[model samples]
Target: MNRRAFATLDRPYKNKTTLDLLNSLAVMKFSKIKPLVSAFPTLINMNNNAVNCLIKKTLFPVFCGGETIKQTIPTMRKFRESNIKTVLALAIEADVDELERKGTDAVSYTRKMVDDLKVCIDGASKFSDNFMAVKFTALVPPGLLKRWSFNLKKLQDHFELVSTDGLLSRSNVSLVQDAFPNLDASIFDKCDELSFSDITAAVSIFGPNAHQLILNDPLSVDADDIETFQLLLNEIKDICEYAQQKKVNLIMDAEHDYFTPAIDDIIIGLARKYPQGFIYQTYQMYLKTGFERMKRDLLRLEKEGVAMGVKLVRGAYMDHERHYAKMNGLASPINETLKQTNDQYNAAVEYLIANNVPLFIASHNEDSIAKACKLIGPNSNVRFGQLMGMQDSITFKLAQGGYNVYKYVPYGPVPVVMQYLYRRAQENREMMNRLDKDKRYILTELKTRSLFK
Candidate 1:
């Protein structure tokens, strides 16, 4: 396809000041000056009046929705006018420390999270027929997840020597004879009956660092943990049901590899329960297992007669995943190279399109977007997605082509959302390099418009 065919930079600016600030930010990002890029988060946190004003004027408009949902409406309206939809994301990080400082009560934390999400859902329902993306971590305590991870790793290591025969059952649990000879075989027998409560109880006995003890056997569920898990499930189900009633789709955002397995399980359960494509899950294609997992999910959904709704991303947690894997002496779950990720991503797109599944092609890569456009010719069940600030050319181009496109517009208090902004900066280096090309496209469009004068 010709470059200009997908380069229609119709509304590059809401006004001249907005245009100038964007161009400046683009230049800074394109230069890849380390200190300049890295200083943004620090500046945001400095709480200086001048710095905050500048960020609100320049950075906020381009990327974020606004401090509140009401403030985001105008931006959402602008996209709607261009035949683009908005994916409303409340740009709040689930920082465990921040949560504790705000409140020590678990019930209070849960209530706060639900209330925040309700605002997002209500705001999104007003304009977009697209999904509202939420992080599961926001609803649950991060400490609990850490404890689960620690316990699971310990349990998996203990079973590493035992011959499981690749089966995860009570029979396999009994095979742990030599590993924990003094431990009651009854514990192995009760594996099937263990609940989250049992797990928490074991945590008290075995302590957090008890690597030697089987702790709460991974073979069984813990009652307390199950209660917490149920609470999370109930909260998400409430959100999904609310979204369904409001005609807004809900997507569970993928996070770090440490938490993703549980997140995936929860998303799958939600998908099964509310199957008409109302609830969706995100799959980050940068992971080596992403493609195969997508295939498996599709097959499972097909068997269950549920329409699978998915948003495919190139992933945002690359650095964190690599670092964590190295630190923990675990095999890295990320794809070895970008090319491998792209290949898997395209393959996933093809598979989803072929199977007539509801798909959100959430990418900014030109080639991937083009491939999806070709595969989705005359199909409305598929939509294109890009983040709010980056890839305007791709987003606008796809939308102008009479295709469904959505921008993930994140909105929250500026101080609270800086982490989200920092993440966008870190992840979009390649896309930022394309800013010069976008600027030229904008210049060309400006000249064309000037000719009419």
Candidate 2:
């Protein structure tokens, strides 16, 4: 690939103010401190005025947009001035216990979340360069999501065991039942009514065709779980419907694997209904099977004429996922190495570019972004996204090159987004180190100008 375009990495920061560079350096420098990073979340949450003020001045400005849409405007305007767009997302998500504690009040909590998201969508509607992002974890109970995922995986496993080598037709229902003698009646009916012989390649690529049934709207969750699942689905549908009316685009943010399968199924279900390009799904490439999932979904969406968008990322939950798997004695799903991840990421990028699908390349890696640009050339269908505070150079360089660039801006109260900011701090250290040479170049330029003084 011709890598000449973004070779001069120094060019990325040419337009950044000296203060911007210094602030970025501070974010990395602070993150590198083991103790401070460790204490950050607890300290921020305690309402300690000094700690809050210091973090608000430092990491808050560098990592998050602001506490609310009104507060987020200045940051959004600054990005707009630089020819970059903003993917605005709220900073709250619910845990399993939180929902169970709420019980029927879960409905009230979801309604409140829906309102908050609509506010974000309205905010995005006001700015042509800004779009909104929402997480399913924030919309419903995480426990419920796990319930749906567990059942889906069980169905997928059963289908895989009985699935034949050749084309799978409705007649294959016998095979599935023969393998799973006491399969649920609902699943059998769902299975008996569906066939994957036509969408062969796409279905086969992703293993069993059971989950594909979710796309067909024949979801098979536990009898007790169905009611709550429908409520969550309806909540998402309401938020998405509002976004569509406003002509605002929505990207569904991906969480950890526990909720991802259900998230993916819900997104495909939404896409089947509103394929007008309003809903985009995220793919985390660090997962070993991430690329195949994206490829399979893309093929199916294409064949079914469902309009959907994709956001590609290397993933964020490596440490947590691995730790959880080890504790539970389950195999880790994350790719074992960075190179494995990068290879999968790049392949997904190339595949999207080759197919001319609308994609958001959400990364700070210079090489990956440059490779995507090479494949994209002058294509406007592909957009490049980086976080708000990190990777200033790469973001600006893409904007300077006249590519579609976006900054993923998280907006919420500092205490509320403490977890997000902390995660950003941890993730930023490695990437910032890689950009040290660029940092020195920016510093040298600063010393040469009185504007910096």
Candidate 3:
């Protein structure tokens, strides 16, 4: 490895303007205080014009792409200059809370969100090698998503919840009695006696074809949830189909565990249709079962002869997940320590590389990245990703090394995207040491420019 490629002062920071450095410095310093981190959402919601202006002028410019598609063009162009592509995410489109706030207008709001995403697809199609993130949270009710997750997890005891690959290729396809080969059909017969409800019982909840269902089972079903669920499925299909028509890739982001199983089901089902890396599923490797999930996905995809499009992230919901598990009296799903998370994340990275899987390694950890760089050959079907405004040095370093890299650029109104900013702050608080290193890098660059002179 070229040591300078991993160095902090490797010229990536050298081009940052004084204002940009100052903004990063402010955010980094603020992240060190736990109370402030906890109160970040409240502060953003205070609704004061002055504070919002300051944030817009300072932190917003540094971290976010912009509030609109037009605003994000500059960000995309700037990153393109660095040999980086953009993963444009519409932060406002999928917030369930915001949709709830729209109460009387909820239906219209959801439609508008979907339309906005269409606009995003149209805009993104103009740029090659760029992708967008889609979350159907606003389209599907959160509580219902959780219910599907619970119901599917129970069903998953027999097989993973996704409809198997190749569900789209054949014309005379028929639903089967078993999704898993050799797993006795009798297992589907043991619903009532198990006490927690079996596959048959799930038919009442998810509808009749539940026996062959993974989480998203049955091409047709008679159930209330399935009806609403079909709306969400239709929306995703329409959106993704349009994207594919326009020749753009769309990444399906992973959400909370309570909602992810159903999302996973839908994503994998779509992955079967959009199998040329046009649709990617994200795997957050902070959870204890992270490695297992990737292994299962890889195995199934290979067995079914489907292409893989994976984005391995270090995870963004550590605090939220841990708290949810604690309050619900469940085992914390997160790894017990940072080292464990890094280990699990790296293991998943190694697993993908070993399988020659097409992947996007999205992390800020240099050691993990260096390890990936060392393990994979030059022609590997691998790319790199890091969030915009975070990890500039490593991102630039990887791009400089002739690797395909993307900056995850989030865009939405400042107030509407507060949850995202709060997560970024929480991420910063947890990564105090990393923030210190970034601050040092900025300070060093400032000194090198000699504004003091």
State the lDDT of candidate 2 residue by residue for 1-453, as single tens digits: 122466554456666677777887777678778787778667856867787777789989888888888989888888888788889889887655553523446677888899999998888877874568888888767876776666556555666566565334565666655533433234334343443323232232123333333322233334334455555556778898998888888888889887786777778777878988768899999999799888877777886798899999998878779998999899999998999999999999998888888898999898898888778765358888988877777887778777788999999987788778877866865665665755666676676674455
Q: What are the clash counts of all predictions, listed in order? A: 12, 0, 2
- For candidate 3, the lDDT comes to 0.70
Worst 10 residues of 1 by lDDT: 203-212
Q: TM-scores for all candidates?
A: 0.80, 0.87, 0.83
On residues 114-157, what C-alpha lDDT tens digit does candidate 3 reach at each position? 78888777767767888888775755666556656675665554
Candidate 1 error regions (>4 Å): 1-31, 44-50, 95-104, 149-223, 449-453
Q: Which stretches of candidate 2 lie over 4 Å from their true place?
A: 1-4, 8-11, 14-17, 41-50, 101-104, 166-169, 174-221, 451-453
lDDT of 2 at 121: 86
What is the C-alpha local distance difference test score of each model?
A: 0.69, 0.74, 0.70
lDDT of 3 at 196: 19
Cα deviation at 353, candidate 2, in Å, is 0.8
